[model samples]
Target: ASAKARLIDVFDLSDVQATYILDMPLRRLTKFSRIELEKESGELTTTIEELTAILDDDGNLRQVVSDELAAVGQQHATPRRTLLLEANASPAKSAVPLEVDDAPCIVLMSSTGLLARSADTEFDASADIARAAHDVIVSSVPATARGEIGLVTSAGRVLRLSVLDLPALPSVIGIPALSAGAPIGAFVDLPANEQALCLTTLDETGCIALATARGTVKRVVADTPGSKDSWEVIRLEDGDRVVGAVRLDDAAARTAELVLVTSDGQLLRFPATAVRPQGRAAGGMAGINLASGASVIAFGAFTPTDDAMLITIAGTTAALPGIDTGSMKVTPFAEYPAKGRATGGVRCHRFRSGEDLLTLAWVGNGPVRACSSSGVPVPLPTELGKRDATGVPVAAPVSHVAGSL
Candidate 1:
């Protein structure tokens, strides 16, 4: 008890700590207690000395902090795998800021009145041999993506169109269907009685020959001057409407001939020299002589060549259009000799029983294509026929025939 009291006073120990020390087994205390105490004292002395030296020197303390921070940063930073770039001035590259490049493109129209434009670069023709639905382009006009074109209507009105506003077709194989385009009716504000006939350029370099249902032919003189977007190209008489129109190279028209086919199996061909250029407001002169109840069904002016072809479709007047599957004949334009202006040239097609009028007719340079009124493509006969021979029966009615430009 006296020893415990002395130890407690010297160590400043509590009663429980003093009792725990005094109660230790004597042999264990003498052996392990000295070794353990000496080792612990040595470690504490080294740690205290090192800490006191670092605290005394400010530079040592800062160095330690910096080493720690650098280690942490090295461990957390991300690495780069690619190089970066910025625009420069060494090589001058002009800025092409156009929303749509002013590239050359072709505007195409389908028989169903749809219109679309496709890029002319790498314009492919390999897929044209294979026939498909909506593959027929009834009319195509060349224009730039940023230029303007003119659309000819059956009512003799020519309306200007912005090329940029047209729907663009993807780079495609074969003739594009123009299914992506809006209906022509949506683009042009036309009367219900009128319809768009074909496409033409608004430029003044060439002339456009037009034929009316009332047997009139007129050449829309080049150089249409006006800021007006739309104007009358021909002064159509009452109940008269344009049946066909085609662009003509003025130099070529000197040798070209105007062909007029009537509904009653009459065809007229005369040198385009027979007609004179007329102002936009001038009424046309007589183009073909038609029997009573017969009207001009088709007309075009073409320079006579071996490639020129005449296509005719025969049907009855009583049958609703495209309902009666008509007969078709493909004949060389040379089969019938040319006649004088305003004279019925010759009988182009002899009608079979129940067929009274020529439902469709075309005379121009071909590779021509045909389609039903509903836009389904119809194949033509491989055999050429005599000028006055009957046409071979077609599986379905052909409503339109168009030649490639």
Candidate 2:
């Protein structure tokens, strides 16, 4: 009782006269009148509103304060004029030009030449010691029909060079020959396997020459009456005979499945076994272009061109489209135009791995471009020069006169 009295005292409940009215009977409560009840109800409502206001203030006190300040400012402020400012933004510019480093220049022909001129600023020096001297030879000389100037190092090592990093030296050495008097033109070094293949022209025979590191030379000749062009040595795999070569003027190999683009632009294929011994195109049966000696016996179409066919060493043929050299777009092979119209028939050469085919193409005024099996073009550095009918670069070393990497 004492505690309850204290709580009531603290809460100020002693002013309520309803305690005695509640203890009276229902009839006696009616005597208290509705006026008193209404007054009490109004007091209870005010108390609840005050409690709610306190709770609201505690929950978001800072927000409530800020909102209250904003409300007060808005209620008392006057409108002001607004001003707008516009600034132009420009696109970012490159710091240098893409073609600046591609300027033409003379390359050094030997390590001694490169090392001697290493400190000189006359020519941009490349770090490829192996190709330094070869690049110099290829760039300084003029193209001649006699034969592409063979690049031999002071150590008597042959260089398979690429024009990509001109003024660079060759890093590889020692390739074989396809035949006697066959001049090796260009070649690539298989660094991983320590072997190399050279593209060369046989003496006066117009035969395809391939030299290997094993001191072996293999030759494939298209002795047919109408075959006057040379063959480009595309790639070398397996052995001296297991190589791939492509005709520069046409997209066909020597032997395997014969894919011939006729003078009228009609494509045709013949199997090695089905080739007639004495009939038309006889004794001219397509033979394996390289030395690996793999046999080709099937025929298939690789393109829609009635004149283009894919000839495999196994005698299989695939039809492809004819290359419209005049209308084709000329871009770096790596940056082949994806949106350009189909200008040339596609020729595919399957590598030993058989995953993809290497596609060589002739486009408008541009050198033949080699595309990967997946259609990604392998950009041949301009220094390599343009390919000839045999798919080999013409004997012009001057075309390789490019600056530096």
Candidate 3:
């Protein structure tokens, strides 16, 4: 006790161990007490060395904290209240910026409203060998998987479809080999009895040329922003409906001419500027003066240097069902004089026997490909000719024509 008192005075005994020693009971101060104090002092010295080593070594200090935390966690662990899944650990609704493949793809739409995507725009196969039973492939347009496609309806409405949303198809196989495609209604809402007329890609800034069966035409700005899935393109008369709609790029809208084809083989070519641009709801000006029974079947835009292909599908009547005997001929746009709007245009294709009606026409700057009902490629005229000539018969019955190939 005396030695401890002297030691406490000599050394600054401010530590916990020194305090306990200094406060020892007076009755336990015996020789045995001295032995006990020595043993405890030795033990305390060992503990001090271990703690000092732990403080000096960062790895050992970290281990001590980890072990203590683990012990506490094990003793107080609780079950999670929320369900967790390995497949969807993160609650992400969609990719940031929507990672869409920008590779080029071909958008195919059948007359029955089935839609599919293919990598090759020039893909060709027989209709019997390519398409499903009773399905007619009507339109195929080349677009990137990231581009927007416009599904123009006979009701004169436009439905926008993202190519990324379209089901991807095998490039080598025909349409019949794949599953029956989704309907147009799957992507856009449509009114009862409303059917799609054509599939076209939208331009960044341009106008949409719309032509109706009653010979009315309108040009609506293509870039008009809207949140709705579909938009009004033209106002139809009581008995008339939109037969065709095409998107004209800024270049095409400025310099291209509009070509309107009739069931009676009348072809009207006029500058796109001839008719002023109209609003979406405006009833359009006259594009052609249809005869009593004749109606417009196709409308397209082309530049003067571009060669246009007019396809006349032979049938008993001017309808898809009557498209049996078909002929496709290419004509230079310079050959056909640009007539005034609402005028009766000159003849573009002379009627072959059994084919007095024209089924479809396609106008663009690039090479055009015509196909039979079965999707097989039909040969186009090797030699370009003047306007208003009889077209050569296709190798098989033709049903559709695709331009800008």
- Using TM-score, give the best candidate's number: 1
Model 1 lDDT vs. the true structure?
Answer: 0.82
TM-score of 2: 0.17
Better of 1 and 2 by lDDT: 1
Query: Which candidate has the highest lDDT of all?
Result: 1
lDDT of 1 by residue, 1-405 (tens): 998998899999999999998899898788888999999999999999999998999999999889999999999973331222335526566688758988998888778787778885444444545665555666677889998888988989889888888888777665566556767766778888888888887777778888999799998787655698888989988899999887777687788889999898888899888999888989989988778999998988889777789999899879886588878899999998888888766999998988888988998877777888767788889999998999999978887777655
Predictions in order: lDDT: 0.82, 0.28, 0.71
> Cα RMSD (Å) per model?
26.5, 28.9, 25.2
Please say which candidate is ahead in TM-score: 2 or 3: 3
Residue pairs whose backbone atoms clash in candidate 1: none
Worst 10 residues of 3 by lDDT: 126-135
Superposition-based RMSD of candidate 2 using all C-alpha atoms, in angstroms: 28.9
Model 2: ten consecutive residues of lowest lDDT: 175-184
Which ranking of candidates, highest lDDT first?
Answer: 1, 3, 2
TM-scores of the models, in the order given: 0.72, 0.17, 0.59
What's model 3's lDDT at 20?
76
For model 3, name the residue pairs that clash: 126-374, 127-374, 127-375
Cα misplacement distance, residue 302 of candidate 3 (Å): 2.4
